[model samples]
Target: MISPTTIDQVFETARVEEVIGDFVQLKKAGSNFKGLSPFSDERSPSFMVSPVKQIWKDFSSGKGGNVVAFLMEHEHFTYPEAIKYLAKKYNIEVEETEQTNEQKEQQDERESLYLVSEFANSYFQKILHKTDQGKAIGLSYFKERGFTEDTIKKFDLGYSLDEWQAFTDEALKQGYKLEFLEKTGLTIVKEDKRFDRFKGRVMFPIKSMSGRVLGFGGRILINDKKAAKYVNSPESDIYHKSKVLYGIYHAKQSIAKEDNCYLVEGYTDVIQFHQTGIKNVVSSSGTALTPEQIRLINRLTKNITVLFDGDAAGMRASLRGIDLILEQGMNVKVCTFPEGEDPDSFAKQNTLEELSVYLIENAKDFIQFKASVLYEESKNDPIKKAETIRDIVNSISKIPDRIKKEIYIQECSKIMDISEEVLFSTLAQINKKDFKEADKQYKTEQRAFEVIKQQPVKKVDVQYVLERKIIEVLLLYGNRTEGFEDLILKENDKGQLILEPVINRAKVFEKIFLDLQDDEMEFTNPKFKTLYYTIIDTLNQNPEFQLKNFINSVDTDMANEITTILMEDERYALDDWERMHIFPKEKTQNVAQLVTETILSLRCFLIDQKVKEVQQKTIENKNNVNKSVLEEVKDYSGLKMLLSRKLNRAL
Candidate 1:
């Protein structure tokens, strides 16, 4: 647990844009920064970060919150992990809330896996630097590959001892559970026996986007005929190889700054490129291309350059990955090294300038690369040439943008000596059957492009809306002292109960609290009700209260609700709201009227709800209806009518 003071300081110092900008590419949109939703794959920007309000909202995924919440949601971090991450980023010393031994033991499984992996990473580094065998074998292997000491330490390269039980015995002796160590795949425990999983191997720590070590990739130094050369941590709670990109933790900033990601196949390829002063490179970490991996890069940039070793046969097979990139609507360029040179060997052989110059001079667009390779393979055979054209056209069809597709098709026609009409026809045929499965799934359903056609619209919850408005007013202007027309239930000359306006000067929160107390009413929605209590209680205690403490102390999910209430106007224009045929009642310039109208609307809605409830029971009754129920409905209806009249609206 983190102490309250430190948590408050984190929320105060961590700017929402600065934090989210590390993950999502945000551009200025009015007072807010907007970008594509990292939670969803969309072409347009709907994710918004508000620096002024210090919150973010992914409208596509409905995930909205403050900075800490963003980390917890995006990176799947625990609350403490998120706080500590922010504390480290901003140089704030975290004041921790002490936990009992039992509380510490009760930590969740995923966090335990993370902790074990962290321990393994730190232990590996210790062995690589401290032990004679590690410095001689693992350090020697990395040094032989031309990696400098700084580069080796930056990537946290390390070596596990050659002995089978070396790491397992050490971990157990350190009080780590065998279950977690085994589950994290750092140790293999079976049949009352345990051993190191990465025995006698150089360590490659696989990390999440936020830099936490998730798993490890290990390489054996002495290649035995029967033994495998490389081994990676099996899929655990934290490590999903398909979704993890090696070096993304270090490459994210450079990728965003350069607006390009250099993708390679192996860990060495990524490291070699980074060593050459090209920092925006990541590897698929030996896995085949995946949409999930591409989307990770997509969050940072829309451009990728696939760098392949000089193996032409390998490049031909790897060309399939370019289609996946094209499907993601990315601008892709492909570059291969000179024959007999991989990224690792080529990078080690050349200076940074040489590697940089070679890439710029040789990089080709996806269409050109695909066409050149396939065309060369086609030779003088007519049938082979025709198949090559179709293959190139298929790649073009993968592009989602029509304009880009046409441009690629035109380029293909010029390269293949084919007509644009022929290429277009081929593309249309390829794309026509692309959605066949989706069409079958949605045959009876409404088309997605058409938002609502025959589907029924959900009825608005009147009371819920009113409750939100009440919360919104309190969040915006709760402490402001204003003259209010306090409606008092009084009897006129005829002795019948009627409402009269009694003038009073009071804080807005005090007025709303008193009225709700007088009516013995509470918010009908749980989310809104909890928020109302928090805001009212805080404002009542200190009339000069600022929103920083309130927003900071609230639960993360509640922060979304708070932003939804506080930043409603950021989403819509009040000036043009009437054009949509909905009149704006609350959030007016006059704070008193905004507060008064919201409370009145809520009262009217609650009264209406009560009358409906009474009427429902009256209809369900088989015996004579209770006289009290009928009077209750009539009296609530009369009060609703009076409140409606005061609001100058008809019920």
Candidate 2:
């Protein structure tokens, strides 16, 4: 468990903008920061960060919270993991109480896998720098490849020893369960024996975007004809190769800053580029590019520059990737190095200045590169040329933006000596075919959804609105002091009863609590009831209660609810309603009135429910002609009328 002081310090030291900015590219919008929703695929900005409030809200997905809550929602982190992430980010010392043996044994499987991966990363690094055998082979190999000591350390490169049980024995002796080790694919267990998976290989720790060591990619040092050169960690609870990109953790900031990403292949390609002063680059770890990986890059920028090897095979291999990039609505450019060299070798051979200039001058837009490359193969055959033109037109049709598609069409027309009219007509046919297929899929899904909707569902709670309103008022204006007026029935000096209006100043929370108690009202929703009491307790315990602090103390679900309520109001504030001549009334001005009205409305609703119950009873007993039941129904109906009158509603 993390110490309360450390958690509080994390909340105080971490800024919402700075923390969220690491994941989403936020641009300044008035006093707050706005960005495309990281939680959804959006063109316009719906994710807003409020520095003043230390919270964020994704208007698209309706997920909102403070710094820790954002991490828990976005990164799928537990409470302590989120806190530790922030502590590491801000360089704050984390003070955690040691877990007991029972607590350690109860850790979840996924967290255990993560711990094993992290431990493996540390162990491999220790072997690389501290041991003689590691330095003689793994460290020397990196040095021979032109990797500097700083580059190797920055990327956390390491070497696994040659012995089969070298890693497995150490990990098992260190109290890591063999089950997690086998699950993470770090240890391969047979009938009765276990061995290290990446033995005698140089290790590259593959990290998630948040910089957690998800897994590793190891390159075998010794040259053997029968063995594969590189092997990667298998899919596990913490790592998915299809969904991860090598060096994304290191490249994300630069990708956002430069507003572009240089997509390469292999781990060394990414590291070499970063070492050569090109920091905004990531690799697919030698696997074919995937839509999941493309979306990962799409979260940061819409521009991707794919760096390909100069060989013909490399060029041909990358054509499908270009189409994939186009399909994601990204502006893709291709940069091929000199003949016989890849990004890793090319970067190692040239100075940063030369390589940088070459990339800028030689980079060609995807359409142009595709045309030029295909023209060479089709120059002799008219049939092949026509097919190439059709292929290019098909690629152009995949672009989502109409303006960009038109622009690409015009460029393709110029390059292929074809008319824009013909290209546009071809694009229209492709789009029509696409639309028909998409419409077919939509109908199929709609039919399924309609069938599901026919099933009976419990009716939504009608008291939800009033309950939510009560919570919202407390969250927004709970700490503000307001004057409340109440009617008191008192005995006068002449021994006659008289109603006197008394005014008193009290916090909004105090006023709402007293008003609800007077009517014996309670929240209907279980979650809302818990939240209401938690807020009241927080306000009572600390006179200077802050919503952000209160948010940090609650669990993830309740915190998200509180932030949603608090941010629902701020969403309109972001619209700057005052400038639009829409002067909204402040709730604080009539806190007492709002509280009384809300409580009265709830009472009226409850009375109406009771009257309906009695009316139902009277109907059920109608055949028997029960006089007492009819009289009870009449009394409940009259009570409902009085409650309605209190709310100024006509019965």
Give TM per candidate.
Answer: 0.87, 0.88
Candidate 1 structure quality by residue, lDDT tens digits, 333-406:
99988789998999888999999999999999988898888888796999999999999888888888989988
Score residue 644 of candidate 2 by CA lDDT: 61
Clashes of each: 0, 0
- Top candidate (lDDT): 2
After aligning candidate 2 to the native by TM-score, how far in Å is the CA of 350 from where it should be?
3.8
Which pairs clash (backbone N, Cα, C closer than 3 Å) in model 1?
Answer: none
Reference-based lDDT, residue 416, model 1:
88
Report lDDT (Cα) of residue 557, candidate 1: 72
TM-score of 1: 0.87
Cand. 2 Cα-lDDT: 0.87
lDDT of each: 0.86, 0.87
lDDT of 1: 0.86
Q: What are the per-residue Cα lDDT tens digits for candidate 2 across 1-651?
A: 899899889998999999898888887765678877877876677888889778899999998989887887777777799999999999999998887756766888887887888899999999999999999999999999889999999999999999999999998778888999999999999999999999999999999889889999999988898878999999988889998999999999999999999999989899999999999999999889998898888878989999998888778877998888888888899998878899999999889999999999999988889888899999999999999999999999888899999999999999999999999999999999999999999999999999999999978676997899899988878998877766666999999976577989999899889878877887878999999999999899999898778787787788788778767766765566666888878766777888878877887788788778877776787777677877877887776765565556887
